[model samples]
Target: MLETIRGLLEGKPGDAPAVLAPERETLDYASLRDLCDRTVERLNALGIGRGDRVAIVLPNGPEMATAFVAMASAATTAPLNPAYREEEFAFYISDLGARALVVAEGMETPALAVARRHGARVLRLRVPAGAPAGWFELEPEEGGGAPRAARPGPAEAEDVALVLHTSGTTSRPKIVPLLHRNIVASTRHIGEALALSPADRVLNVMPLFHIHGLVAAVASSLAAGGSIFATPGFDAIRFFRWLDESRASWYTAVPTMHQAVLARAARNPEIVERRRLRLIRSSSASLPPQVMRELEATFGCPVIESYGMTEAAHQMTSNPLPPRPRKPGSVGVPAGPLVRIADPSGRFLPAGEEGEVAISGPNVTPGYESHPKANAEAFFEAEGRRWFRTGDQGRFDADGYLTITGRIKEIINRGGEKVSPLEVDNVLMEHPAVRQVVTFALPHPKLGEEVAAAVVLADGAEVNEHELRRFAAERLADFKVPRKFVFVTEIPKGATGKLQRLGLAQRLGLVE
Candidate 1:
């Protein structure tokens, strides 16, 4: 695997555009590399280099994309969600022990105050007008904090490139430090899975703070000497327009964003006709098979659903491209790492058996940072390989396809009857009026946990709760059917746009 992200640009045509921002001049390979070198030199001069953490808080787009590539080369980059509140920012900044903060110049954010309270230096980046899309200059604030590095330079394969916190739906977020090897391995895995080349251009709609965006969208494309048409964020209205205008070969997004695009796709037939997409990928969440069918039917392209997490640096498994069969609901074969099903006793399970999903590979994180207890619990030795328990319940088919049943903690236990939420969601989505559905465990005094579902109806389509329950009853066993149906215009999503199935009961006020 390539040692550093900066090395991905090597051997490519220097004048070819690598970073494309909407309405701005694209950053060619030469300029992108130049910008990366300059940024690292500046960070080194500021006394921040390998082993030091710098928190990045910038809006989504080319700057966010390029900043990640630059900082990871010289220092450990921790990209934080800009949507965080002051309190959230305070905790993350303090937790990360960030040596400095990176935010766009003149952009006010709560991260500034949080960094100040922690005594971390603030480095404001300015992307001057008419410069390459990703080109920016950093200006350190007056009275910066003490420098951490004696001499700064590019990092080695063992050095941590990026540090991210887990979503922590059930427990406190765990810090995940990804080394240069892990990132490079995952980037190459993704590029290979998608068959990326210099001519392949990815239209990035995922959030920059997330591993899916950082690795799948930016790193994967750049690794293959491809271009990334970076967007500010996902906009359903503008999605088709961008696809048509950019002539993007592929785009990867969560199911929620895909549903949003589907909702508006009916009105954009011409754009769909003109847009010839080679592939459409769904990740970070399961793409309901119903939505996948519609996407394929509408666009006449294969919808590849892949499995990923921050722990694996992004891709763990992915459905192969054309000429290889793609199972509709399954996440497909392991694309990057060695994946298997493991029992509670840490024994690897055989095919057709359900258990916790475990992965061991170069891309897997060495371990969670600074948390001995978490590291002990998450990693274990099996088959002479160190496997990290994913906490996801799944099984491998005889044909080697992996079907994720549910998160171990998210499984609904109704009087000891374990229920898979994905099964229920898939059933409910079969209803013509049900556009999107999320099945969750609702608190029940007698049964401990009861199955409940929240649904977003199709546009102008009305189907009552009774009809939906009856529909599920026909397809599922009685215990697996959702008892309570909560109809909402929109389901609550996390910062990176993934639907939170574990804590959804609290978010819906169905549990205390």
Candidate 2:
């Protein structure tokens, strides 16, 4: 992993300009390398070394990116969102057994208070204006016994590099430990599937804290010797301007972001034409086929939808670039490793059969950290190979294209009939007035559970429960149609910005 990071620092011929930050200042290959080296030195001086756990709580920006590369160079990097509350921070800090917590200088973040409560060392990162100032800072303990020396040894392929918390949709988040081999394998596959090269320039708006941004956007780009334009967050207006000014060739984001971009495309035709993006990548959440087609038509580029999770270290599969017949609803073929669908009995189902998706490869983590129950239930041995259960239902078509139907737990059961909430949501999204839609299960006296939907209408557009239900009825069966519709300004999202289906019923007072 360190070798890959170092290799990117040595700019190859035909490489685009160094990675830029429209939000912050840009960093060339040499400068990024120096920052990584110095950060390693600082960490070592603070008694952190190989295999130690260091927790990071920062926003998405240059500091977050630099900190990730630096920590992975020496010790295990555990990056968490800065928005976590005090209780949430306390749980993760104590759970991960972190040796130290990294935060911004003078910032009163929850991690700092949680670190002090758990007796974990607190490291303040100072961000310089011109230079990378927010680089991690290590504060030595009082009466420090013998300054610990930093180990400059290379990271082994099997060494654990990152420990991430799953996006707790149904329950509390579990820690997923990813090894150096996992990172390298997954990023290499994504780079290959995207045909990334030194000539490529990626416009990365995804949050750095998630696997999608860390590996797919940053790591993959670096591995390919390509450059990235890192934005602090997704801004539709600024995104269009940067797309033109930076001349970014490609970009990656989630479905919500794609919708926002598509909304702005009509006003930004000149910029889009001038930039001529190679492809637009979507992951994390399923992208509605309607949105995919709209984005492609608006931008004049293919929208590559991918299947990924935190346990897989970002990407499991991606739609092949042009000339490969990008499927609208399909997530494309398996990219890095072997992908299969298994029935409830743990038997592998053949192609064209819908079942639980399982993956096996170097990119897939061995198991969760200190999560024996999850490990036992999620992993299974088949044909002398260990496979990780993705808990997602999917199948391969005749052409080997993968389409994820929905999550196993996210499926809504009406009476005894099984219905995919994603299927219902996708149909509702096509309504002219519907801007965003989330389908979930609501409790019913007779049916046990009934389908319910929450929708956000487009600006100045009017929609009612009667019209919405009528719209869904046209595309779905009576049982599949939502029994109740709730018009809301926004839907609730989890920490990673994914819609939480299980909690929606309870939060909306639909369950007693």
Candidate 3:
């Protein structure tokens, strides 16, 4: 297996497409590899090298994708969401202690000012209109010689290739450093699980900064010697157009994106027929089983639901391809990591028992970067192996399928009786009037926490709290029914479009 991002292009035909931007010239494997070499040389000239952190903020597309891979090969790549505000950029740049910042030639983002405040060298990336997608020239700021490092070659397995922050929906974000081997191991695992080959082409619409797009889409495709049609970002209106024109063999998206695409599917028959995807992948968040079935019925292909997080380097488990039993509602068996169930004290649990999901594998990060308290709580020594607790509550079936119940910290405790929001969500999704729903915990004066939900009703289908409560009461116990129902047109989502169950009550003005 390829141990570094640079090695992913090895042995592939130079003419095979590697990265594609919408209406832009394709960068083939040879060109991509050459571009990486040139980019590394430039980074070297600018005094960047292995273990040196370089923060990158660019629009979502081929530039971002190639920049990540190329910069990560020689330095620690810290990709920030371009949508971040001044405060967020300043915090991340200072927290990362980045030595340099890379931005588009004309990009006037607040990150530039933030970088200046931190004294991080700012470099402009220039891409000609006619040049291939991955081609770009790095221009240093006027008259600047940045800090220099001695190391200037391809990194080893132990080198940190990527650094990302936790979404921190509940607390302060922690930095996570992923080694080259961790990501390489994860990429190979994903490519193997998806049965990727050079014949396959993936349509990438997820944001490049996220782990799902970096490892699950770009790195996996490169490791397989396949190709990527890197769209600007997820746009439901232009989704079918890209799918058809690119002739994508498969594509991956979050649950929200999949729901949006499914909403527009009935109006686009020709596009659907023209690009018959071999499979569909949903990750970064739990895929509602109803949406999964609808996608399969519409696309006539298997919809593989995978489990991933930033700390896992992207993929942990995934539903296998055809001939293997695909279980609905389960994130499937462990694809790469050795997944097990454990109690809070780190005792292993048996099958059919619900507990925290623990994983130990090469794909998992060594630990959180320099956070001893987080490391102590996140990792534990059990049975002669170090296991990283995934913070997710799940169980393994007799057949070895994993069903994620909910996050441990997000589970609702109504008068000491535990309730799974996912169970409540599943029951509510069965309602004909419910289109999208998020089950969360509301502050209760006496009970400490009460069940609550924010729901988006289907078009022209209306339902009130009383009716939804009645519907859930029939399928669930009294304690499991939502004590408070907020009929919202849309639920609040995080940066990556994941429903953040934690701290939602305060955001909705339900709690002081």
Per-candidate Cα lDDT values, in order, are 0.91, 0.81, 0.91
lDDT of 1: 0.91
Model 1 TM-score on a 0 to 1 scale: 0.98
Model 1: per-residue Cα lDDT over 231-297, one tens digit each: 9999999898788867899999999999899989889999898887889999988888999999999
The better-scoring model by lDDT among 1 and 2 is: 1
**How high is each candidate's TM-score?**
0.98, 0.94, 0.98
Clashing pairs in 1: none
- How does candidate 3 score on lDDT? 0.91
Q: Tens-digit lDDT track for model 2 on 1-512? A: 43334344455543234567765556666666666677677777777777778998877776787778777777788898888899988888988999888877777887887898888788777765566322334554434653574554434566677898877766888889888778888888999999998888888788877899889988888788787777677787788987986788899888888888888888988888888988889999989889998988888888899999989988898889889888887899999988999987789988899999999998999898788998999999997899999999989998889888899998877889988988888899899899889999898889878999988888899988999999889989999999899988888876556666777988887676
Candidate 2 matches the true fold with a TM-score of: 0.94
lDDT by residue (1-512, candidate 3, tens digit) is 26888888889999999998788888999999888888888888788899999999999899899999999878999999999999999899999999999999989999999999898889898998799886788898867675556788777789999999998777789999999999999998899899999999999999998999998999999999999999999999999999987889999999989999998999998889878999999998888889899999999999999999999998999999998988888999999989999998899999999999999999999888779999999999987889999999999999899999999998999989999999999899889888889999998889999999999998899778999999999999999999889988788887778877888899899888
lDDT of 3 at 128: 82
